[model samples]
Target: MNFETVAPNAVPEGAPLIDVREQNEWDAGHAATAQHLPASTLMENLDQLPETDDPLYIVCRSGGRSFQVAQWLNGNGFEAINVAGGMDMWFESGLPIVSDGEGEAYVL
Candidate 1:
């Protein structure tokens, strides 16, 4: 019930950025540092997520999918926050984006 949208800059270093969009959508654009863990695959790879209970930023092209993923992550054990407005906002705000093979995809 304490869902909060983290500011782009507030995103800490080395925290996992969960991208819940489909592969095609992700290939078009995404936060460069975000991980390609589509929501469909999240439940299967929860073990790969960082152990910290802090908060992993869940994002998508829009807010819908990311919101669902965020809720599920909340029920799991890790603290998850949805990036409000999702990738649209991140891009509109002039934050960096990574297209298919255009830039770095992982932070660590």
Candidate 2:
């Protein structure tokens, strides 16, 4: 399966941002506009995926899980790309994140 991989800053504005991290990580912090679809629950919720010709952006704590998800989505006919440095890099790059709990938002 072939798919593109790009850094956090390179993800297109308003592209479907899929957060493949688990709930705990998501609760800690995630891109303000990201959709949480933890890799573990992805298959069951595949129907919820957005419809778009533009590439779907997948992110995890680091890059591993997102890479796997991007491959899977690509195999399933969606144009998906792995966010190369994942949430860590996104946070480091000063991107906005949302936190459900107390304290400063952090990439988990």
Candidate 3:
């Protein structure tokens, strides 16, 4: 179960970043380029994932949930990496964030 992990700042621009937080959290704020894929319903929405051999970067509010999802994805034959420290660290690292609305994007 040795899944890979990367810091938020290390995630390259345009990489497929999947946010595994819930609807509320996603609506609050998230990485500007991240895709919404709540961990609760991820399995049912596998079709939404990018169809590429490249690594899929997963994130949550913190790192816990995304870590679990990354492990599951790897076991299921996908190259997924857990974003260490998640959105909180992403925000702390001064990365760009966007909300569902026009307001300021803060980590939820």
Candidate 4:
């Protein structure tokens, strides 16, 4: 099934960018505005997401997992967009990213 997609740099400001990577990946680095929501726990934490009329963006180390999450969200009646190319692209695009430490981390 095809879900919506948005380029990493095209994600709108203030949109809920749910990072579906594991906690370690999240701790390493993530979009400055992204929310930590590992795909493993997404279904269980659905209620914790922000209420938005616009499509929510899903991101992972690469595009694969987030694409799956986007498909699941769409099937569940939630508008979701997979961030094509994911965090790697986000970092390549020079977007602001936050990390627990000062050093850079791998995206995938």
TM-scores vs. true structure, each candidate: 0.80, 0.95, 0.95, 0.91
What Cα-based lDDT does every candidate model obtain? 0.76, 0.92, 0.93, 0.87
Backbone atom clashes (below 3 Å) for every candidate: 0, 0, 0, 0
Query: Compared with the true structure, what per-residue lDDT tens digits does model 3 show for residues 25-82?
Result: 9998998889999999998999999998789999999999999999999999899999
TM-score winner between 1 and 4, please give it: 4
What is the lDDT, from 0 to 100, of the residue 106 in candidate 4?
Answer: 51
lDDT of 1 by residue, 1-108 (tens): 677677665667777888888887888788878888888887788877766656888888767788888887787665888887778777777788777856554221
Leading candidate by lDDT: 3
Ranked by lDDT from best down, the candidates are: 3, 2, 4, 1
Winner by TM-score between candidate 3 and candidate 1? 3
| Candidate 2: worst-modelled 10 consecutive residues by lDDT | 47-56
Candidate 3 TM-score over all chains jointly: 0.95
Q: How far does residue 61 in candidate 2 sit from its true spot (Å)?
A: 0.7
If both were scored by lDDT, which would come out higher, candidate 1 or candidate 3? 3
lDDT of each residue in 1-108, candidate 2, tens digit only: 567899999988998999999999999999999999989999999988888788899999889999999998899888899999899999999889999789988988
lDDT tens readout by residue for model 4, 1-108: 557888888898888899999988998888888888899998899998889898889999879999999999999989899999989999898887888665875564
